[model samples]
Target: MSPVNTSSSLRPSSFLLMGIPGLEATAQHWISIPLCSMYLLALLGNLLLLAVIQSDPSLHEPMYLFLATLAITDLVLSTSTLPQMLAIFWLGPRSISFHSCMAQMFFIHTFSSVESGILVAMALDRYVAICLPLRHSAILKPSTVARMVLLILLRGLVLIPPFALLLWRLPFCGHRVIPHAYCEHMAVVKLACADTTANTMYGLAVALFVVGLDTLCIALSYTMILRAVFGLPSSQERLKALSTCASHCCVILIFYIPGLFSFLTHRFGHNVPHHIHILLATLYLLVPPMLNPIVYGVKTKQIRIRVVRVFCVRVA
Candidate 1:
């Protein structure tokens, strides 16, 4: 295929984001209603989770600290893309500058990596709490938790630059129209005119290394946790031990299920409708952030009580 406008510049100055493919004409305005509602819920829920964790000293243990980290990650992750998405849906197709698109891509992937790490940390917290009950406090002290959070941030920062750099070196065909609502890494990479073998392989490797490893670690942690729980002396003890993990398990499912589906469909689902892929991609980001706090608030008694008390105090 002959390149369009490639002589002027190797890359376009801005990308035209086409929002959802088929639905952009008629349905996008209606779509914004639920999208806006979900974004607001994500904001409210995660902020409330952070506020509750911060206000109550009693809840400042390793698990809740990890919860706070997850909440903050969720807040940033949703904010990075959703507002722009809303603008596109409510107004029309929008153009994002090359640098701005790259920035959005970095923030989305980096914080997503951070969130996956946080889930592993939460699993570790549960494992330590269940398997090494006496040593849990000593092992996951505030200082240690702080360092872990720092390392999670560092992992994302250190790993994601290569993605942008790899794409930066490639020549675009001057067709700068991105078919999705936001700047997803693979979607943007597909716009390049050159052979994208390196970009594709590197993205796959990173996903497998980061998310794949995190999933393995979480599975191992829960394996040990279940063994320790089942070995308890009484049924009641087993049930109590299992109950502690319920919220984490739910959160993990909600997060990973849709995410993996979206990832797979993006790469492999040639037969799938473009709108379906876009909707799945958008939902994966919004759903987890909206549901995470609710799952914790309902499953964990401490958060539930504090959430109630927080409202009651405000009312009085």
Candidate 2:
């Protein structure tokens, strides 16, 4: 029925995961509706952000360019799964097919990789700006930023596809159902009928190499950036630098801390409540996408101005 990939018979789901009431069904009756509302807001905000960056000549530099690209990636990464996942929360059969599972898993991982790369790039941009203000423009030129993005893209193409394919090659003959909603790597891979030691090892390696490494590097970059900011000649300069980095630091913390905790708790924490687990899973998918535009808008004045300018031009 789907063109995503090779179709197999819908495997009989073994896990109920949720209870008889199917919170997905009763969710509207009790749970907050803002979950879906916020996702839509983020989608719109990111679109406005992209339009702003494209419209404003002032925002053509590497930093905003990367931010715009990050916005697009966030849109795609969240849209890949959230919209359908939301639908399931409101509708019946909150289930995904094998091929659809693979596709979601790939995009989720790919865009996650892209986000980490963009954050590192943003950190580098800040470092250059603070430590070498005189040559910031030359170091972070448009061409260089473009090339960086292109490299991330090429790497994603080369690396992400193989994981998706490898996942497909494994059999899901055991438990047809995944424990969580959607096709998360750890969640779905557990369902595979074939030995999952290889998949689990690959997933763990990727997590450590990609997410772990990114966090460590970003932290280091900020350390240097902070030291440089503190050594600045003027109080005004220090304040400005801190202002610019405040939102980024908050965004980084927001995105990473919960993710690390959730990943760890899910795998190791014992006797976790069903609702809590599901909520963390929901946050993992939703928080970064929703908060990203807000982060950029609040932290970067240029992006805010550009967003207003683009909207005004459209209105005129």
* Among all candidates shown, the one with the greatest TM-score: 1
Q: Which candidate wins on lDDT?
A: 1
Q: Per-residue lDDT tens digits of candidate 1, residues 273-308?
A: 999899989988899999999999999999999999
**All candidates: TM-score:** 0.96, 0.87
Superposed Cα deviation of residue 212, candidate 2 (Å): 1.9
Off by over 4 Å in 1: 1-8
Off by over 4 Å in 2: 1-22, 28-32, 309-316
TM-score of 2: 0.87
| Candidate 2 lDDT over residue span 1-316, tens digit each | 5523222333432332321124655663344367777788879888878877887787788788988888888888778877766665666445565666767878887887888788888888888887788999888888899999988776666666667666666655556655565566777666666677777777677778878778888889899998988998999989998998888787788778777876776578768765567667767768887898888897788777766776798899
